[model samples]
Target: MAINSLKRLALLGSVAIGLALPARAQDSGPLLDLLVKKGIVNDQEAEDIRAALVKDFAANTSAGKLNLSPALTEFALSGDMRLREQFETQRTIAVPGTASVANERERVRLRFRLNGDLKLQSGWGAGFSLQTAQNADSANQTLDNIGTNYGIYLARAYVSYQPSLNWFFTGGKFKNPFFTTDLVWDADINPQGFAETHTTFLNGKDTFEVRAGQLVMKDNAEAIAAGAAPTTGVDAWLFDQQLVYTKWFGAENLSDVLFAPGFMFYNASTITSQVSGTNKEQAYNGSTKYLKIVTLPGEVNFANIYGTGTQLKTYWDFTYNTAANDRAHQSVANGGYGLPATTNKGAMSWLVGLGYGYGQGKNKGDYSLKADYRQTGISALDPNITDSDFAFNRLNQKGYKFSGSYNLTDFASLTVTYFITSRLNDSINTKAPALAADPTLSDLNSTNTLQVDLNVKF
Candidate 1:
């Protein structure tokens, strides 16, 4: 009997090791259980054998040999990919001796992103991501260049700490921390700076939160000449703050309202054209220092509408640039676009939207439909950071956007979006022409865009 038990133990050890290489330690449970049931080993002995098997397996597996830092309690990886078909058409109004012209374009684009997160003890974490595009406002890469390999960029790298349940802090280039819409800020922009957030619950269900950020827009160094003193330029910065409130309604808390009001202040010098014999240089458009904006964005959501698993959502966004200066662009001599003062009334923008859906586009058979109308003033928001698909990212525009999305599977979805837009002020030319003879200065007559996308998430 003693000899038989020893042989049984040896066989079990071999089986455990073999299974552990490609499987987890739990995979050896059945063999251990059978040995104990047949009286080849007692429960205590079986337990001891199981522990030994696990230890041996750990020492032999790649994960166990990784020598990961003890500070890292958990790690996770996730990402998504998107394929798109895009169509765009733009009409340029006729100038004095020119005829109106329409330009149409079609293209295929792709985007991919990968993200990694590491969690450590003491409420501290770090994250990083890689994406396919270099543009701050876009992640899509045109499938051109004769099939050349795409470039990948570091999209996000940040460290976060949550000292307590109600407070959080983050530093480095990270995702937008404000509750906002594309009407004022592009969705793809990751601001490089520091953010602080604090939240407090009211009535155990409702909550109020405060978020603030100090972000760097541009860094300027002094210019030195052979015989002249160093001439320094002011660095541009964006200071932002927002107040958010969420309130739940209905007995089951299936309905809710969210309101976030925000303020943005830009601190920088105005851009001016370089003189014929000077070393000074500036952007084509005037300075961002004129942008002091206030925004109000809110939404109301009703879930399980009439008990049918359908939802209804209504949302709106409004912004006003308090520091918009018409004289900034009143004349070409002042580094302006040479537009008449009356045509530069671009200090306000707004949008209203409605949406209905059977599901949140999560599972198969779930679908959603949405429509929105927006009007953007020339100086209401930063034209460089607006939605690229709308009016070709131009300001002084009004338009309607329609979209539909359906989930093909839990991890994949198909979506279609259309935009119909035209210039809000016909007198304000969309292009900032350097010379009066520049034909591109024609007013933007119309713009239409269509996009179809296949997106997969993991």
Candidate 2:
């Protein structure tokens, strides 16, 4: 009996050591302590086993070989890749002699992103990310160009300092810190500048938060030439502030509500145009003198309705540009739109959506369906930062969006989305004078878009 017990103890120790090889150094301590307490091994024997495990791990595993600094407490790597097939159709109105035209296009695109995060001592953290494309509103690369290799761009590089549990500060080109929808900002856009955030807990159950951002839009080195004298160029900026409150109710906090009210100020006097990596101008084709906006965004959630493992979600966003100036909408001869100033208020944008889901669509067997209605005015939101897929990123449009997603595995999912939209105002020109031959009119009347995507994450 003694010999058999010794053999079993030896086998158990070996199994434990093998299982702990991929785990962190501190993870083997509990198993070793248990072995010592159960009389399976002496203290010295447990120590010997631990030393052997560490040595073998360092010799075998790539992560174990990493010489991380002592001050670095944690590091993580994560990313996602997506393959997409997109289809689009646009219709043009007929004129006196010209027939109506419909243009259709189809393309396959791919997007890949990789992110690294490092957490240091004293509440400091840094993060960086790489993406496949250079567009601020998109990360997709069309699978063309004679099968040439694509270029990767630096998408996000930011450092954050959290002096306390309730306060945080970040600087550099970073992720959007505000709670918002694609109605006002694109999902892929990372704003460049600084942000401050604060949170207050109420009764340890409800919370209120404040978020502020000062983002640089453009930098001009030389003075801007106006009518007579050159005006000193002021670096254009977008300033944002928001207040969010979240409350929970009902048993086990099954019902939750959240509301965020925000304001934005865009200073774009010196921003004439922006040249992109493709040497194409991206935005600011039109004047952006007045773009102060007020926004209200909110959501409500009910968990485990009727004891089912599903959630019901309703969300909405509303924005109005208080500084939308009629003078900016004057005819092209006046350096504005082709329509009269009084006819183009262009001050409102809003969306309402509903979703039903088992999970957030990130786990195996998880599925979700969502539908929304949206309307955007020409001057209601920043055209350069809105969703690229909806209405081809054009303003003065209203549409219905439908999407569904199902996870095939914990790290893989399939999604399909459709957008059907039309012009909100048929009389005004949606394009800049440089883009349209008829500066006073636009030909495109309606658009339809479809996208199918397969995404994998790690």
Candidate 3:
């Protein structure tokens, strides 16, 4: 055969080997050397074939560009950054008392986050995220006027064991296991805990899922010294369980008439050390209670609303306080934080939300408008987890919130939100002489907040 024809044959063989073999096993040097020694190709021709094979492999394998490992089955990196301007206003409107208002404050804040996940071949995986924030409930760092250095926190870290596609277990600081809204759990709060989830596919477009978790809210060495029982080394723990059902009407999957309804039971223990004789739930400050909250939450989704690529969604979350009734009964006898004589022991809280949108704030022209109304009683919930942007994190308030967002690109968007709320209980304000004297601090008045945000994600 001619040397030129041999060189072409060697090149074709080398390219075939590169395509046939696994990415990590595609090195062509040994085969090229063998071909050179057999006299089928010269040294220069062998080197040329090796170079072409390397180029082909590089173009075909993701590991060549991303530096990914061959042993990993899946890997991903994702996150978002946000810039915000917030305005908070407090005014006492049309009240039968001396008018007192709080000075409005405007602040600028920035948030940056990065997350990575790696799934190994043995059905196990790990993931982590880092974010800028001052507390667990928020990931935003205020742009300081004094040029202070920003701070970053470990937001999430977890390892997962997936025995099958339908079952998984996670341990460490991880996202909340239960499906929820900001009405109960803050969006930014990743609880330190262990969780297990299982899903069962039912007949024809119906699915059932169950999730349970034991989360650590806080740890107190003082409680340990004080001999707090039923605690894991003096830790405040939350036990949660959720049972959810997803039903799809017709045959279009998520785009059709889809509804997800779920029931959640949450109980917190050993969160407050200063427990009264019988009112054990009334330990965490005056507003919050470490108690049991039973919630029913559901969402109804409409796709292609009004002939546009928009989805009209409506959600409702109703929570009843089993522990609050117990606390209320104890308060009358134990003389606790001024519960009204005729106050209903069975306190309940609820929120209703309506929204229209497409995508998860991903693409350009992806926009959403959402409005929510929430009414909470004083003892209905642990107010510590309430959204800080609403009513200044106050319980015993009835409020409405309006939010809208427009995506500018595939990974960037802008959002605007407004919140207004009024106090639900006027008697509680009169119970406190100082609050009754100051209208700005009174719960009977209304407050408003407005915020604008620009966000980028990858």
Please report the candidate that would top TM-score against the real structure.
2
Off by over 4 Å in 1: 1-48, 51-67, 223-230, 250-254, 270-286, 306-308, 326-336, 430-443
Better of 1 and 2 by TM-score: 2
In angstroms, how far off is 269's CA in candidate 2? 2.7
**Better model by lDDT: candidate 1 vs candidate 3:** 1
* Alpha-carbon deviation at 189 in model 2, angstroms: 0.7
Candidate 2 per-residue lDDT, tens place, 1-458, comes to 13355654684567555575444654777877887899977777767666766776687778778899998999999999999999999776455456657889999999999999889999999999999988878899999988699999999999999999899999989999999998989899999999999999897589999999999877765554467676556677889999999998854225889999999987654454542321211233234457789999999998888456688889999999887663235212243435654566668999999998887677899999999999987668776677877776777779999999999999999999999988787666544434344331123567899999999999
Question: In model 2, where is the ten-residue run with the lowest total lDDT?
Answer: 277-286
lDDT winner between candidates 2 and 3: 2
Report lDDT (Cα) of residue 251, candidate 2: 40
TM-score of each: 0.83, 0.87, 0.78
Provide the lDDT at 189 for model 3. 78
Relative to the true structure, how large is the alpha-carbon lDDT of every model?
Answer: 0.77, 0.78, 0.70
Instruction: Rank by TM-score, highest first.
Output: 2, 1, 3
